[model samples]
Target: NKARMSAAGIVGFALEAAPRTTRAQSMDVLSSQANIAGYKAVLVAAHHYQRFMPMLMTAAGTVKAARVLILGAGVAGLQAIATAKRLGAVIEASDVRPAVKEQIESLGGKFLDVPFVTDEEREIAQGVGGYARPMPPDWMRRQAELVHERAKAADIVITTALIPGRQAPVLLKEETVKAMKPGSVVVDLAAAQGGNCPLTVADEVVERHGVTLIGHTNLAGMVAADASALYARNVLDFLKLIIDKEGKLAIDMKDDIVAACLMTKSREPELTS
Candidate 1:
């Protein structure tokens, strides 16, 4: 696809090209869409879940608050934590990046700490480019053990772990789904990329071992209006990087964002202006 575009003398910009930094944050389409997806994931899970999210006390009986487990503490995961908390759910989240522990706590979600025993594990857990790098096999095994235990107690689980351009990590195994309580819901935001839960089917809601697995690839599309608004703003902000003050289309290759977004390896003559 890139070769075809370059062969046709077309200069293209990647919408998700902006680095996750304070200066270029407004132009980050990934973050914008993820924010909406995270918010929607909780709502979707609540809709499918038979039990109440918040606890209630009455003369007849008292209901316990739902336990929600979130895998991944990126933009989507953090937003999911906040949304679930608002509905009075007890949220616990896990991520390879230890840096997100504070963010999860700030949003009223408990951080599931997977201790790094080895120096190599600790270095890899730091991740790269604001995204999680694939952890060592030993570390992943440890995380899986922890997640399995947590999933059994959770009424709702949302998995958002994904490594860019790679298959999504499998956090929740098949056994974990089977161990979850009856009528539990698992929302896999990483469904498009094979999912964090092995049971998830992309764009389908399936029932396995009495657990509902929501594998909607495009959660942002579920709340289309707001998602579109946010995306359009991101596009507009990105346009400013390529358009000059005089209203002329100016592609400045020197600009960090512009350079990062350039898809064609070779510069196109038409874009030189």
Candidate 2:
């Protein structure tokens, strides 16, 4: 085991680095982990929530369906929409990407549109590839205004918007949270990235302003069995890029996956604009 570990020499590699290429996507650990995180987030919110997710008809009365609002239409956000839809919640989602409208509505989630003004802002909203780019302060203010209005009507809020190498933008502010209805619940998946909610405390459940804010980091970790299994599979598949068929150490620096993931070999990180 030590021999194989030493052969790869990828121990200190930043496994969380961007997996942009088709080959790299096969070993994308973030997506595997995020799939579970999104599913768990809804369950966690439902458990802590006082009201039922689905509308109920009983001898007594008809209970209204819970309103679920999701921020960001990434893998986790999409999964959260599907999971919540399964539970019969009326879902709404917001994202910077203009095309996310179709993705949200495809899963029965109403897309909250925050229109872009300037040409630069419009270009920025689309981002490089399919990921999110940080919007300028003016555009962000407009988004915050729209999000604040939507949050007030939501019974459960799952915030997943994240900007790489920066703190998660504050979507739900302290004042907004205080004004929400009693018994509302918020699951901030971006807590580890400094949280989309200002009130969130990383890895802690905060009860404030008649609402419960779950700032738990690594929601996938809550279900360790599945999370670890998927993570292990991803890591093992990535190792195949460096290991030979005879099960011997064979470092192939020419391989893109090997070159990007190789940390032991000193190389300057490319941070191009």
Number of the top lDDT candidate: 1
How would you encode candidate 1's per-residue C-alpha lDDT over 149-251 as one tens digit per residue? 9999999999999899999989999988888999999999999999988899999999999999999999999999999999999999999988889997788
Per-residue CA lDDT of model 2 for 188-215, tens digit only, reads 9999998999889999999989999999
Sliding window of 10 residues with minimal summed lDDT for model 2: 264-273
Evaluated against the true structure, the overall lDDT of model 2 is: 0.85
- Give the C-alpha miss distance for residue 144 in model 2, angstroms: 0.6
State the C-alpha lDDT per candidate. 0.92, 0.85
The per-residue C-alpha lDDT of model 1 at residue 148 equals: 94
**For each predicted model, how many residue pairs clash, with residues at least 3 apart or on different chains?**
0, 0
Task: Please name the candidate that would achieve the greatest TM-score relative to the true structure.
Answer: 1
Question: Which pairs in model 1 have colliding backbones?
Answer: none
